[model samples]
Target: MNEFRIIEDLHRLQNQFASLWDPFVAAGGSVYPALNIHKGSDQVTITALVSGIDPDSLDITVSGNQLRLSGEVISGAPKSDLGANRVERFHGKFQRSLELPAEVDPEKTTAEFKNGILHLTLPIRESVKPRKIQVQSK
Candidate 1:
C-alpha cells in the first residue's frame, strides 16, 4: 500500500539523519583505527575497525615484534548527496603501530581487509610458545 511505502521511506530517512547527527569522535575516530589484539597458544589475532576507509589505501605490515597499520579515508560522498549542503565522512592519512605482546613468526603473518575491517594473524615464534612441564606429585 502507498501508506506502508511512505512509512518505510520516512523510517529510512530518519535513520540517515540520526547517523549524520552522531559525532565522529564518539565513534572510533582515532588515527589508530581502533584494534583488539588477542593472543592464543599459536597465534595472535588483531582486528581493526577501520570503517569508511578505502581498501586500496590500507597497508598492514609486521616487522620483528611490531605491527604497523596505516591508511587514509578518501573523500567520498553519496551519489544522491553530490548537491547536498554538508558531509561528515572523514578524510586523511592515519597511522598506528602496536608492539606485539610477544615475539611472533614474521614469516607466518597474514592480513586481510574486508568491508572496512582488517584482520591480521601472526604465528607465535616457536621459542615463545608455552611448554608443558611434567611434575612429580611430591
Candidate 2:
C-alpha cells in the first residue's frame, strides 16, 4: 500500500529469485565469500572466512548503511609443480556487498584480520540508538 512496502516486496522477490538459481550456479563456486553478521545494541559485527588470502589484498568500504568487501586470492603453487588431478580451492577476484539494518558510524568502524578471518565492527549511529524516556506523573 505504501512506497516502502512496495520496495520491500520487490527486494523480497529479488532474493527469492536469486535463491531459486543459487543451487545451479553455486556448483561452480560462490560469487561472494561466506559471511556471518551479528547485530548488537551498540554495534554490528561481520566476519568473513577468507582463507589463503592476504590481508593486504582486501579492500573494505562502508558507505552509509552499505558495506562492500573485495579481494583477490592467488595460488602459491610452484610453476614447475606436477599436474594436479583435483583442485577445489578458489582463486582470483571476489567481492560481496551487504546492507545493514541500521545506520553505522563509519568513522568508528574497525577491522581486524587474523587466522584467515576478517572481522569488522561497526558502531551504531548515536541518533538511531534506543533510549528510555521517563513519563512525568502530575
Candidate 3:
C-alpha cells in the first residue's frame, strides 16, 4: 500500500512538472513542420518537412544566425455537405524560427522547395568563419 501511494504521488508530481513546462500540449497545440539542421565548416543546411503547405505561401527569412520559416497548411478536402466527423491532420498557419549554429550570409543563402520539403543552404559569413593563424618565429 505504501509503494502504491508513493507511485501515485510521483505520477501526480510528474503531471504538474509537465504542465509547468508545456501548457500547450494539454491545450492541443501540436508542433508542425519538423526540421533538421546540419552545420558544415563553410555552410549550414536546413531541411523542413512541410507536406501540406503551398510553396507560394511559404516564406523564409534569414538574418545573421536566425532563420524563420512561416507558412500555412491547407487541407485539400473538398467542402462536404456534412462537417468533418474525424480530423487528425493539422491545418492552419504556422511560423517557426531557429537559431543557426553559425552566422550565415543572408544574401548568399539559397532555398529550394520540392516535393513537400524545403531545403536551405546558407553560406557562413566570411567574417565569422574561423581562420588559422601561423606562429611567426621572433
Candidate 4:
C-alpha cells in the first residue's frame, strides 16, 4: 500500500513485461544496451550494466569517435534437482556502442569489470584541453 511497495510492484511488472518479450530476443540473440556515460575533468567514464554475462566473452573496441561493447551471455542451468519453471534473467549476445561527445585518446582507454558492471575510462587528448591564458597590458 505504501509508495515504495508500489514502486517495487511496478518494477516487477516491468520485469515481467521484459521477460515476455525476451524469448523473441533470445531466438535472435542480439542486443543493444543503453549505457550511462559520464565525464570528469580529464577522463570520460562509462558504466554498463551487464548482468549474467561472462567477462571472458566480452570484447571492447574504440574507434575514432566510437566505443563498442560486444559479448555473449549464456544462462546457467538450474542446480537443484527440482525443476525451475520460471526464468527472469535476460540472456543472449549483446553489442552496445556509444559515441563519445568529444574526441578521446583511444590508446589510453582502460577497462575494468566488477560486480556485473563494466567500467571504462577514456582520457581526453591534451591538445583539446584548455590552457590558462594570460592577459598583457598594452
Q: Candidate 1 clash total?
A: 0
TM-score of each: 0.63, 0.73, 0.75, 0.65
Ranking by lDDT: 3, 2, 1, 4
Candidate 3: tens digits of C-alpha lDDT, residues 25-137: 36543445667789999999998888878899998999999988888888776876655555555566766666789999999999999999999999999999999999999
lDDT of each: 0.70, 0.76, 0.76, 0.69
Superposition TM-score, candidate 4 onto the true structure: 0.65
lDDT per residue as tens, model 4, 3-118: 54455455545544554464424555333443668877798888877877878899999876677788877867556756545544555565555568667898999988899888
Task: State residue 47's C-alpha deviation in candidate 4, in Å.
Answer: 1.0
Instruction: State in Å the error of residue 36, model 2.
Output: 0.8
Evaluated with TM-score, which candidate comes out highest?
A: 3
Q: What is the lDDT of residue 70 in candidate 2?
A: 89
Residues 6-94, candidate 1: write the lDDT tens digits: 55455545434543443433562433466788988889999888888878788877877887777787656555623535333444566
What total of clashing residue pairs does each candidate reach?
A: 0, 0, 0, 0
Ordered by TM-score, highest first, the candidates read: 3, 2, 4, 1
Locate the minimum summed-lDDT window of 10 residues in model 1.
81-90
Candidate 1 TM-score, C-alpha based: 0.63
- Native-to-model Cα distance after best TM-score fit, residue 7 in candidate 3, in Å: 29
